[model samples]
Target: MIERFRAGVLAAALTLLLTGCSAVMVPVSPADSSGLGRETVRVGIAYDSAGRGDKSFNDAAAAGIDRAKQELLIEASEAKTQAETDEARAEALRGLAAGGSNPVIAVGFLYATAVGTVAEEFPGTLFAIIDDDSVTADNVVSLLFSEEQGSYLVGVAAALATRKDRVAFVGGVDVALIHKFEAGYVAGVHSVDPGIRVDVRYLTRPPDFGGFSAPAKGKAAAARLIAGGADVVYAAAGGSGSGVFQAVAAGRKAWAIGVDSDQYATADEAVRSRILTSMLKRVDNGVFQEIQAFVKGDRAGGKKRYDLKVDGVGYATSNQQLGPYQSGMEKARYRILSGAVRVPVS
Candidate 1:
């Protein structure tokens, strides 16, 4: 079963000026006078399925850890998730923790069980998991994001940008987390026009992490939706999203929506124009901030959330083609933030 609750209130906006065809993140060093005795914190990252090259969730988390490495001067070790299993995940985390990785970070919800098991054994090691809050151990911290909120915003963009009143969603996996993205998207499209047609599909089921890695599957899924009259497609399918981008680019009048990072800046130039916008889930910020908090000795175990009101999630504006939908996007964002509209988390 899933749950729903309002996130804490905060105000901020993400503005990136894309000058050289890509967004370069400036390293954020720890502030002066924290008074921590150690000069550097050793971090061990147990990455989610498909590893750092997936160019989606895992990659976003990697960017943050990289920033920490450069700015905080931390010694970090990274390990990718192996076969989807409690034992495999736990062994990976235990290897990191046993190797003196103070803050062992697990990068996905799949590691929830592994993290709980390992954090219990290594009580002194601080553990962090992204997208999973089931663990309540005193030594663990769960960094969660309002993915639905950002998805809703981009859904609005899709609704406003579609030429054929038809949009589609391609999810990496058929799970609760991906369902959150699906549910909010349906609502957003309906909010724009209740009669608009929306198509939804998932690449793979749980225990088979192929959905996040198989770009060929994502491409085929998007192609099917496009053939079925979907002119706009949103992909929350990690590296598999690359396939969706490819499908949309090859189509006649179709557009693609990216997830996690800004595909407009990161995607290939040939397909870049086909990507109207992306639901910017700031995984990098969440990871970096949590690490900073832990460094300051504030590792209280609980859900540390990111949401729309705080700029934790948003839509990419790097593409000039999305300018036409800016006013409506801003209005929808205001509604969501002002409680006039509430995004469902499935």
Candidate 2:
């Protein structure tokens, strides 16, 4: 009955908003003024080869978890390999269920199936899965990213950085989420310079999403795109984006855009110098907020979409990555942030 109530309350709250964490927009309890420390909140991060130290996807999420650990007295651990990802997610859910940990966070959309299976088995356990809407259990809070909007910003930067009106999108896998990035990037370029061309290629077509972690695959894909007239290539592959940077550096005048984290800081010095900019997805902010809510006994649920409307998603710190962009690129960023320009997410 307690589990059912929690699920029902979550469902009722979700239709009112989307996403997990503070973006849920529901009310939050006051700080635990009970003069006692909040018990530990366990967060599970499963990185598929993009792994925790990739300086990008997994790294960004890990930073968020670390923030939560610092802000609140919580326990956190991550799983790097495919097998570990599966086992860790299951173990986290089961353990949290046995305890009363509300909204145990599952980082990365890659854990959709694992989260689904585990969340279902542990109905009483509240879960927040980042970057996926596929899990609809009332007990689950889906954290979907408006990657298109962020991708659009970087697309505009890439378009301006390109000396030859040619850019490319290098993706980890051709999944639906990644497809949105490709479409939005191409659209953003056309939005700026109608004749600008973008080459599209994925490190792995399908069945081998592992390409996201394979630097060699990223290098090959980026090289092919570079050879095909792309003077600027934005790599949406997690760790693979490094390979994209490597290939871009090798090109005559190619630039590479990093995804998930600020490549300017995360990429190797050689690759970092070639970086155009990055799409900053605030996974850390979301993770911190979710843990905060759960710690305070705020158990509300539903899908929460993070996008430009909220800081949940957007282009990264422009820094020097955007210094070379045409004056128009800066204007676009300003317009998007100020509501003068609305970047599409679909």
Candidate 3:
């Protein structure tokens, strides 16, 4: 019987490897056995291609989970996709749900289809997806953000900081979601100076998400932009934004704006001086709120829109270089929150 059990365990481990579902379960604390009646909720996160140390989007989501573990005392499991295939994502989700995670969070909109399929398979489990709102399911909640609003504020900063009256926007992927960043940035720059030239570039088109993870491509794109007289460049690329910062640091009198998180705070000391500011998307807040809602027994799944009104999006003012431009960014922020400025998503 012991040999049979060992064989079964080996087979199960092989199955997990074969499916590429690398879910690592981490218990925050031992189960409450004192009869205090405190139940520890289990949470799962399926990260994007860049995973935890991307220092941007995925890291923001990880922050929320970390907060939950400390405050809510929840057990957590995290999985990253080995490949950018739909099947790999689905397998990761399946592995988490089957392992008894109550709420499995898919960290990116790219997981929309996978979440939809897996949520159906595990009807009792609650699932939350960030960025994409197309998945309508009883077990799934969509955490949407107004990225354009934040991008617009950073755009204002870029416009005010640029000495050459020429700015650029670098996108990781040519998708609708990223287009929102470009649209808001261009609008903000033009709002300050109507004739200011804006150079836009995308590292990769759809289905080729290498743009988000490829730092070399990001560096090349930003270097070209700086060489072409763009004094301030805004990077809406995920992990690739690091390359943009590096390029800006290497350039003479060039500045770069980051996206999703306060890149200046996490950036290397050499590049921090060059990062003018970052468009804060607040993915961490969104992730934490969803998990909190689930734990509170408010499991009704629907779309929750996070906008400037709720402080869900804004510009980071970590770098003291932004002190001179804070007034302009604040003015833009007031306009957006007051409904006076209708930031474009396209």
Candidate 4:
């Protein structure tokens, strides 16, 4: 089941400008009123450009915070990046940290530089950054994932499901992080059938993060791939995956794959049938566990890697269309976990 929850939005009057962006405080669940004396810790999340409604990467992170709000004695607030500039990201982090939010969480790799710069200024504050490990600090915890390992499993599914013996990968941005998805997918496709052709396209290049949020661009990219004979399409784009699904559905015979969250569960009923499977990147689990550690006074900071062996990343089999490929995907999963298959990150 895909757990969906929306954070109560504060009124515009409550919006506070920390630097140039607004940090809206989300109304969190009440603390435990029992005699256990539960102290509420304030948690802040700095979201990427797409924010909460992206239903992909940002939503996965929000799901984690929602889980924390329900299960832990905590208050939460979130600030989103308005501009692609590093200064804007730093300001979001600054605003959250300045407002007394401990263990401020940066939701995407885009915040790596901002987190490192802001962490130095707020030495007492604990910051956790997702999808990034470049920030090395006593107060920073890097939450990294084995994206290629999970992508490889989905690639295997795409390879097995393709009718034209041609598959395609749609990425939101042409960055090093997204390259891992493309590499694993290509590797997985070739593993199943060395003769099958795999095509890759990115919506936008670096510094222009709009690619993650542009559905039109995603649709156009997928449409082109489908026109070129791709029978199965995998999109690692953020919100843009929705467009890819639409294009795949219109293609009628093509299958679409989702990333980060189970797009099969979240997709529209019209397009849900076309989704073969999704690459599940458990960002929610990572965020919830980080919060749990913070609540227990275990704020030790370092790099924590979530991989196939730990069930941190895998393929979602929510759709019935994925049934035929389950055994093959499982075999691929085992191979990855057993170190027999070394997925490429480039």
The TM-score leader among the candidates is 3
Predicted candidate 4, C-alpha RMSD: 10.8
**Residue 233, candidate 3: how far off, in angstroms?**
0.6
Clashing pairs in 4: none
- Taking the tens digit of each residue's C-alpha lDDT, what string does model 4 give over 177-201? 9999999999999999999999999
lDDT of 1 by residue, 1-346 (tens): 1222222111111222332123223233457353334235788999865887777888889999998876656778999767778899999999999998978999989899999899999998889999999999999988899999999988899999988999999999999999989888888888899888999999999778779888999999999999999999999999999999999999959999999999888898889999999999999998888777766667578888999867789989988999999898899999999999989988
TM-score of each: 0.88, 0.81, 0.89, 0.88
Tens digits of per-residue lDDT for model 2 on 13-91?
A: 7854543332222243456454223234555555555467888877877888888776675666555543535665566
Q: For each candidate, how many residue pairs have backbone atoms clashing (under 3 Å)?
A: 0, 5, 0, 0
**lDDT rank, highest first?**
3, 4, 1, 2
Which lDDT values do the candidates have, in the order given? Answer: 0.86, 0.73, 0.89, 0.89
Superposition error at 70 for model 2 (Å): 1.6
Task: Give the C-alpha lDDT of model 4.
Answer: 0.89
Clashing pairs in 3: none
Worst 10 residues of 1 by lDDT: 5-14
Please state the error at residue 13 of candidate 4 in Å. Answer: 42
Candidate 2, which segments miss by more than 4 Å at Cα? 1-38, 84-102, 318-321, 324-327, 334-346
lDDT of 3 by residue, 21-133 (tens): 33322222346343222345789999987899999999999999999887777779999888898899999999999998879999998999999999999998989999998
